[model samples]
Target: MIAVNGRDTEWREGLTIRIIMQENKYTSPRIVIKVNGHVVRQEQWESYAVQDGDDVLVLHLIAGG
Candidate 1:
């Protein structure tokens, strides 16, 4: 199982950060992603693998003038 934004979800095997972003319809690299309390780099998304019981946090980027 994987926890996303405080909700538990079934583990999706072979799910990479990239795939997760795609599944969630997020294409912007500006979004922040944290897996198991660690920030995942943009280039590492394709290689960062998510496992069962992992906590994934997806945060949107906020900008201000």
Candidate 2:
């Protein structure tokens, strides 16, 4: 299993960052994602694989000043 936003989530084989967002319905225009304490670039999300026992942090950004 993997930890997403501090909550335990099921870990599945062939899981990617893109899948995680879709599963959680995270579609914020601006956001950040961190895996295992390392930042995962937006361009790499589609191919970035998430493994079991991994810590994933998805933060939705609020923009407008």
Candidate 3:
């Protein structure tokens, strides 16, 4: 199982942060992603593998006046 946005989901094999973002229709890297309380570096997104029971957090940034 994987926790995404506070929701637990079934774990899918061969999953990566980039793939997750793509699957979720997130096209920008401006947002931050934290896995298991640790921030995942942008460069490592493709290499950062996600497994069962992993907690993934996707935080979107907004700029306002």
Write model 1 residue lDDT over 1-65, tens digit each, in one string.
89888987778788898888887798876788999889988889898889989999999887886
Better structure of 1 and 3 per TM-score: 3
Instruction: Please list the C-alpha lDDT of all candidates, in the order they appear.
Output: 0.86, 0.93, 0.89
Per-prediction TM-score: 0.86, 0.93, 0.88
The order of the candidates by lDDT, greatest first, is 2, 3, 1
Instruction: Give the Å shift of residue 24 in candidate 1.
Output: 0.9
* Candidate achieving the largest TM-score: 2
- Worst 10-residue stretch by lDDT in candidate 3? 4-13
Clashing pairs in 2: none
Model 2: lowest-lDDT 10 consecutive positions: 56-65
lDDT score of residue 22 within candidate 3 = 87
* Candidate 3 local lDDT, 4-65, one digit each (tens): 89887777889999988988898875899999999998899999999888999999988886
Off by over 4 Å in 2: none
Regions more than 4 Å wrong, model 1: none
